[model samples]
Target: MTWTLKLVNRQPMKEKLGLLVQHALKSGVAAGHLRPTEIPLSIALETPRIAAHGDYSTNVAMTMAATQKRAPREVARIIIDHIDDSGHLLSKTEVAGPGFINFFITQEKWYEVLKTIHDEYEAYGACQIGLGKRVQIEFVSANPTGPLHVGHGRCAAVGDTLAAILEAAGYQVEKEYYVNDSGRQIHTLGRSVFLRCRQILGDAIEFPADFYQGDYIEDLARLLVDREGAHLPDMDEEEAVGICARFAAEEILSGIRKDLEAFGVSFDRWFSEQALYDSEAVRSVIQDLKSRDIIYEHEGALWFRTQDFGDEKDRVVVRANGQTTYFASDIAYHKDKFERKFDRIIDIWGADHHGYIPRVSASIQAMGYDEKQCRIILVQLVNLLRGGSPVAMSTRAGEFVTLRQVVDEVGRDAARFLFLLRHYDSPLDFDLELAKKESNENPVYYVQYVHARISNIIKKAEERGYKHMCWHDDFTDLIKLPEEIQLIKLMARYPEVVAQSALLMEPHRIPFYLKELAAAFHAYYHDRNKHMVVSDDAGLSAARLFLVSAIRIIISTGLTLMGVSAPETM
Candidate 1:
């Protein structure tokens, strides 16, 4: 059954952490006391809406008390008593706040966490959960009818980063872009371009009012003129429409590639929708549906009885003119994806397509696949902002801001970071001016600046000639500070954060983790020069060096997961 598992096994990491907690609880139970999972080890690793919880806190004991038919405080005591005292950074452990277990870690642990950081600098927080399972992520599949706007950019960033995160966690990943070039839209684009070309050639032409109007149209028209110049004879409606469609499709696809490249989005596949047509997959699908009685004649057109499979209304597969609808090709395309033997099919669609979920899922189900295997994410629109005011962009008016414009205006790093900083479910307001700012007022800059600053500090330390000293040696004895210990525990949680982000399909979690990690690093660095860790005092220096190393590695790991560069020196 396992020719080779090509998907990630993410449960192991969760099991490992859970088992550690379980071991502590088991030890408490052997003592004949009410042992529960609620004893919080030092430095609460919790999601805090209120900042004063001291990192992570656990109420597992309280919850278990009701089930075990025992008192909450009694169970909490059982957990606290058996916790391994070997936790060096743990300073004070207490059962508090309604049977919750809280532990304070020593600051020296933070320094040691730095050492752990340096020890695994190349692979800090990396996990083997994926086990090299193959995963394909398809995103930013905007129709090549127009330039990519901020809306498309979000899908690009999120899809790319999700792939990166999964890859970092040990998955074999592929990033793909699905091109909608074989649809009615492409024909419209061609008809539009052909008329523009004929007009440019001084030929009498009636332009279609529904054709795309953009300055880029002139460029495409000129390109056609460049390629066909003298050979271009007078074209009739049929000849002009076909020529225009092919030319516009090629040019627009090229533009899409260039724009995505400008924003650092690379795809392993630019699958053609027309491929479905060329391969006769659409015809085959229609025939198959007809054989299954899923197809019926309606008003001289062929309609798919999608309603039988849960669609709100029956969908027309073929018009009276015998032309295929976009949905017909889409069904074939998704069926094609499934036939590719991909264990999972992920599509990052625009929010406007939310209503299509039911039909798409139903089709996949009807095609003999689990509906769950076809996952669609609808990312809300990104409202571009400048100086706290919304910047409305309309492609119909040819006033849209391209992905290139955003990347060029703010640099690729900031653009990608800010786009993914907010939960994809929420509305993200991307401020061009704020992103372009050179100061730390921007969250991206603040996070990146911390990495750069750490690099500088490490460089300065090496310049002072303490490069060979054991970074974590002195930190062992120094791992007694509360702030330092808190940071170390945070370092240990990076893998957890990454695993959660991957599971939730939320890339924003990575950025949020980086912010919190940066805050910890900044807190440690702010007054360290005044209360310096004498780098030459071998023990103290090594300890502090370890802390520095941890920060560097964690930053590198976080940045890597986000698909951003973590420079040694910013």
Candidate 2:
């Protein structure tokens, strides 16, 4: 299976620097200072923490000293001396710490980053690492038995942002929601709604101990009575339960769809678990496993030899009573995904499913597919807090806050922003009070304020009789202040940050990067001695406007990726 490559349209500054460093290393070998055969397979360049150290730092010499049979400092000197600076990309190269070669990019060259952002606009951070490979991300596959709670909201935010990130990195991405409408959960939903319906028909029936107790069940009951009241009363209990189940499942799924859509999540597919059973895909998978000697009858129940493929134990695919396990449907679902020819399949499951990972991986291997073709992302629980008190939630008893309620309370922007503010695998403490605040302490407001502040500056510039023009004007040398240089450097790092986030499958890094960029812009704006955006010198004013425009572009691009908005005004 060959995938066409869609390389980045704009060459990143880091890649260009890496190429320069590689060229210098080869030059050193050609000049006889280092052995050509001893060249390392890969070279790494990193940004130094202290601004005084340099813009970029590499420790290749230190790692290669033993291979080249020379002192680390001598190797560093050889590489630095042979480095070509004719392009004037580097201001100077110096040896720092034992053998670290630090390259300081020319201050004027950093301004070119602004031009790249202006040219690419919304595509400033987009790259092409995935290169048109088909990848399907299945996330927020909550069963249609209830409303999506705050935890599911986090999963939705993470999954949606990850899809956007992968698309930006040039993957042919499809987002999907797996509907678990075939299982025991659906039966429970139906039974719960049916009991409520009997009550609506004036029956004094007591609710079961294990029945769903959500108010939404009452809504589904009312809906079912409205649609099938006359027919339901005439039917037997078993037949009515089936009708109630189907109606309740569809209604709950509709509500789930609306909640996700309101929270800015959309899926390319909504796969039905019952469809697998209806089409006999589940039976076929079991038969295939049996034929491959991967399945055996143990105590009258059919079992898959998952223990042989790294699972802790063999798992039952079907019980003796002829009921299929959820595991069976999951195996068929994954098999169906691979049959669709996606090069990569990602399943975002809740953290409680952590133990289920090895078995699923085993299932893929058992089905004659590479385990590496599938990746499982586990999203941890969200601890909803109000002030300092923990919010109580029990989904079975329906005492939890719905995701829609959170979005309505704090607005969609804040809800989504806070959800991704922390790593998905780590437990997130969502403070209801803070998320709704307009102060700088709120992360969403802090980052968004930078964007709004930049907009105000642009508006102020236009009011001063200087209309903002296209960013093709040269202002590279005009941006000389240290704060201006810092902001440009941060903006230049946006593409690399996005690429790293996509490669690592960590969208949380984006919010952290945005915070840093926002802080840099705030510092630059508050520098007392100069009016950075509006000035007497038209050249400097244009230059400052260009800087603000680049900042706005990067912030908006990142916010869009997180499904959060970048407002023009506060």
Candidate 3:
């Protein structure tokens, strides 16, 4: 399973067709049919939005018309005249509208996808487009303050699924969780816990309103009291708070790890902010930036000239009090990431951090690395709903619905699926009642049912003593119904969909494709006349069975990419 072999086995239809269009342009140029001095470096082929337009439409002719000194349609006609269809790839080629070249692939050529799917099975849509580039994706790096809420859950799902997609597209990926363990928040958490411990010890201390009010803090305090009750009565307040902070941070982080594991998210590394300071990396980065003149003193503060590299203004790396800002640590963290030699660094942050992109990009650029190498994905907030009404959540007050609660209530499959129902940048409204439903209204159930239905069909066929038939040369001819053709076409587009999704760094496309595929299968299944997988006609039955088996494989693959389950039953 060399990368080259994988690519050869799954070269997408779009790529193959694009090559033909490229050849056509070259032929026209060489034969002097067009007046361009040289052909363009690449030809762009896109699927026509309207099915009636054609399977694929390219506007290369329009792009070349000026240089060719001819009307767009005339250049298109000349390109069509020179196209070599020796492979029988296109059944019809039309020059339509101003200059677009529309290609209708032959039915037989489309059927070849069925054999490819049969041969490839689980690896049908996998591609080597990434060529094993090393990519580090840092995500769900939620501060170790409290239990993860639904918003964190959504970020987890998006990052995990995006990693899966990049892997399928042949990129070596590492998932990371950045633990912000050293900050004011951790001290606040410790103080909160220490106050709770005093209350547990019957002290009449007033709890501050600004401290963490989550019930989890009280729970941590109780645990701490049970572990060190005898010494707490005599311990110094600052010393006890430090101990409590360390204890609470470690406990909360442990719970965070467990919840992510239960949610099917795992990290290759748990990077600590304190470690950067301990190793002097943060201070070292500031000095390096100062030597490069990227950092300067301004009004008694150390400022980084971020505005010089596209930021709205210079940013303070260290305040007048001489404490380093979070931005300083971030610069050091990203500098370390670049030094690690990953081909790409991806950070998934909450949408509220959208304004922070430019400064981070500036930091990367200031560090002498291309800012493009660092990609940031912003995940929007998730609004949890019960029966369409909003579920209130206050993180500091600790009334929020934890990711654990959602998973426990609706199961991991539904939770992950619903979290990824929309793009990461768009706010998601996750309805608890809708997600738990067992009917088609539940998108996960709808997609998973396609796999289950096909599984049952195959099982029933086997029980009826129908011997399993491998894909045959004539199977395509037998599968000529409009519905069957449509399914094969959709399946043929799977490889392209995956490659495009990876290229665009979008994982939502996978679910969108799966839903479309499931709908097509459901429509075909409900029409009883064409729905039988095992019938008197052995050839047709075998072809239909193979068609559905391919469908099952795709459904399973898509769900697996989303970190969802494709259950055999319900």
Candidate 4:
């Protein structure tokens, strides 16, 4: 049998089943077997947990039953009867519990996915769900006063992976890091370094309790002394502190850049908070709000009417002392984002910033944009552990584990994969020992091992003189084992997984799907007698080789989305 490769990407198996269900509903209406009401614009199809249920299940019948004023199973029976399987898409259909229509798809239909993976290769799981809309994801915008911590690492992984998933779903994506390089924090950093510099020059000084106490402050002071030859303490104190603040901020920001680069995250822009003030954007926004009466002076401070736009209460944008609040700069920053014309604005902030979302979203609305356009993802903190015991960390004391240190301890792949194993909103307990493990207990190793195992199998097959076949070759009946069919079904769900993960704006779904796929493949591989890939039967070996190669492609693609590598060797 000759196979024809279609130029267009094939619809996912779930989508195909949805279309078939829609066709059956229309056919039942046309035949007068069911009452004509409204059909759902989009039907929902789900996979059954138990293997015996069916390949795909849908409750469209039950949804229609309420409108049809008929028993659910009766409607299900009518719909299933009218289902047009002329394309040989389904082997059988059954009305299961409570009117769910379970569809058992044909083996030939399932086999088509292997060929689809072959035809599309790396692009197999990609879809055009995003439709080229512009999206800006701002994450890990940690204050430049200190190095990034474990929590910042989680934010980086989630934001970067979400951006990659959106890109795969066809969104025009840009990643941004907002730099908080101004305000009191920077001044505090300057004072900390200046005090350290004075102590370095043999002047005994008592370090203030409020000052930053990390050894990094001393490092910065020593660097300043090396550059200026211990004359900083002799200069005017205020002028010297000003110089120290600028120097320390730049040095810390540079370290943040190196750490993120090592963690494999790059941003399209680094927006400056000070630039907002310097360019008068902050003043301009406040003036605009005043002109529109959105800002009113109550206690000698300018307050934005956030309550008008769904906030709990009005907030002060400019304090009574005439200095703009951090909220003022936030308003200006988000207004700048809207002015950039991004269709969607995503902010990945720590869960502690949960209360800040309402006011910022209100600012977006006050700027004459839809508040819904700005999406805020709050990531919970990471509790660092060493062999299940809590790892001590104190940010003010500068004794916390930095992102650089974590990446150094556990490789980037392990750090990233473990960071994404759960949803962003859920707190993660990151164990150093577990991440360093190379065995099956470690998730990254488990997933990466599947790719390596498949590579070794393909190499062994090539050495045994098995030529890889083209997509046009017919291999339907050759891969008939239960495990092989299950693998094909799992592989077929990848495109849907990518699309859904993008739709929900959750990057954890990709890792979850990959872990499931890896477990299934491992089970099949370990059962060597029944599931050998390179058997003496040339036709069977060739077909199994084709299936395993497709699996490898999916694993590699999933890992790439997570910013992890798919090594050919463990």
Top-lDDT structure, candidate number: 4
**By lDDT, is 3 or 4 better?**
4
Model 3 residue runs over 4 Å out of place are 1-9, 36-38
Question: What's the TM for model 2?
Answer: 0.96
Please provide, for model 1 over 197-309, each residue's C-alpha lDDT reduced to its tens digit, 9 standing for 90 to 100.
87888878776557788778778888888888834546567777788788888878898899888777899998888888999999999899889878888899998777877
Compose the digit string of candidate 4's lDDT tens values, residues 1-570: 133325332778888788888998899989998888988888999899987789989888888888999999999999989888777888889999999989899888887888889888899999888999999999999999999999999999999999999999999999999999998889999999999999999989899989999989999999998998888988898899999999999999999999999999999999999999999999999999999999999989999999998899999988899978899999999988988999999999999999998899888888889888899999999999999999999887789999999999999999999999998878999999999998878999999999999999999998999975565355777787888888999999999999999999999999999999999999999998888999899888888899899999999999999999999998
Model 2 pairs in collision: none
RMSD of each: 5.1, 3.1, 2.2, 2.1
Residues 418-441, model 3: lDDT tens digits: 888898878999999999999878
Total clashing pairs in model 2: 0
For each candidate in the order shown, give its overall lDDT on alpha carbons: 0.75, 0.88, 0.89, 0.92
Question: Model 1 segments beyond 4 Å from truth?
Answer: 1-17, 24-56, 75-95, 103-113, 204-206, 528-539, 568-570
Reference-based lDDT, residue 547, model 4: 88
The collision pairs in model 4 are none
Off by over 4 Å in 4: 1-9, 30-36, 472-474
What TM-score would every model get versus the actual structure? Answer: 0.87, 0.96, 0.95, 0.96
Q: Please provide, for model 2 over 1-570, each residue's C-alpha lDDT reduced to its tens digit, 9 standing for 90 to 100.
A: 122211321577788788787888999988888977666655788899998889989999999898888989898999988888776889889988899999899876776677778878899888888989999999999988888999899999999999999999999999999999997878887788889998988889899879999898898888878877656757887788888899988988999999999999999999999999999999998998898889999899999999999988999999999899999999999999999999999999889889999989999998889989899999999999999799988876789999999999999999999999998889999989999999988989999998999898889889998885565445766777777788888888888889988988999989999999998888778874684578888888887888888888999999999999999998
lDDT preference between candidates 1 and 4, better one: 4
